[model samples]
Target: MSITEQIRSLEELASVDAELKILEDQLNQERSTLDALRGSLQKLEDKLKTDRAHIAALDKTRSDLVAEVRQMNQQIEHSREKMNRSRNEREANAAQRELEELRKLLRDREEEIGKLTTEAEGARQGIEGTEGEASKISAELGSQEGDISSRLSEVESQKAKRVTDREVAAKKLPPVLYRRYEQIRSKRGTGIAQTSDGTCKACNMALPPQLFHRLRREPLLDQCPSCNRIIYFVSPAAAAQPVKEG
Candidate 1:
């Protein structure tokens, strides 16, 4: 390619690189959001599983306590009836002692049942709250997943096209120039830069007056002294060309 043609190709390659970067950033951000949503959902599900297991254990304990308390009440009644029929003070006192023991055990069991009931209720309430949060996150994830997937597909498609464009642009340059451009892009994120008013815009440094004048008068492949980026001068007409066309 002629020097001017090669400059145009470099510009086109730069544009493609810029677009590709934007596409990559979009993809990363979207994927990160999707992963975070999935992670949150998984945590909530795990907590629900553990809480349900705890509530089940509490229920089993409460049931056993209730049954024991009922049996104790029956024993207390039996002791009272026996005391009523006792013929002497010794038998009556023995029945009274048995009744007191049964009542104390029943009281303790009832208190245990009460504490278990409170714990179970608290756990149930926590589950309800977690479920509500999970539901909200689920709905949001469902909606976001579809939208982000569509957007990611579109970005990938655009990136593919830009890649092809970059390849074509790269091929237009001489091999040496292409390799140099690639090296510069790898290190600096961009290979070429423009000059205006004797300054290398890439580095904000003044170009050599002799070099700047020559670049403006004739197209050439050159590098800025300060930044080492490929340098070009934008003639008034060239500057007016549409960016994509250039």
Candidate 2:
């Protein structure tokens, strides 16, 4: 094809691509809401796992504390028997001091067990609250997913049609030119921009007078120096061609 015809085909492809981009943005926006909910649910689940593990550790510590208390009680009982059977004042005083120390240690340990019991209870309640919240979100997701899925499905079908249209448009161009367009589009998100005057709309930089004049005078496919996108001129005569009534 001549350069003019190639430029026209590129222009057509660019138009289709612009529409495709809008659809793509819409898809991302829609998916983001669902993704955010899923992310929140995942965090809750992780917290529940951590809290349960903590509760289990607390229970183990409490059990060990209880065993220690039992041993302390046994020691206190033996000390009491020794005091009752003491032969003299010195022996009775020694047994009394030992009994006091053991009782104090027992009291401290029992207090710690109480605190642990409270902490474990708090963790259990937190797990219950987290579970409830997770259930609510799961239910919400189940309710919302049907509508979101249907909407996404419809958009995907539209997107697929445009993808086929893009393939058709791409096949019409020479391989080298198409490759160049794809490369530019990968970097700039667009491959071409039209100019009626000398201004590059993509970058908003005015083209040099000589460069703009050449593009207007010739059937050339040129790049905007500022943005490096395939640039073409829109002549007044061509722009003035009336749209036909369908």
Top of the candidates by TM-score: 2
* lDDT of each candidate versus the true structure: 0.86, 0.88
Per-residue alpha-carbon lDDT of model 1 for 1-246, expressed as tens digits?
Answer: 688788878888888887888888998998999999999999999999999999999999999999998899999999999999999999999999999999899899999999999999999999999999999999999989999999889988988988888888778888999899889878877788887578776777899999999898898879988878898998655452222211
**Candidate 2 lDDT tens digits, 1-246:** 999889888988987888898889888987997898898899999999999999999999999999999999999999999999999999999999999999999999999999999999999999999999999998888888888888899999999999999999999999999999999898888888666678776777899898899888987888988888888888765642221111
Give candidates' CA RMSD values in order: 4.8, 4.4
User: Using Cα atoms with residue i matched to residue i, what is each candidate's TM-score against the true structure?
Assistant: 0.70, 0.89
Q: Note the clash tally of each candidate.
A: 0, 0
Report residue 4 deviation for candidate 2 (angstroms). Answer: 3.2
Superposed model 2: Cα runs more than 4 Å off: 236-246
Best by lDDT: 2
Steric clash pairs (candidate 2): none
For model 2, what is the error of residue 6's alpha carbon versus the real structure, in angstroms, after optimal superposition? Answer: 1.6
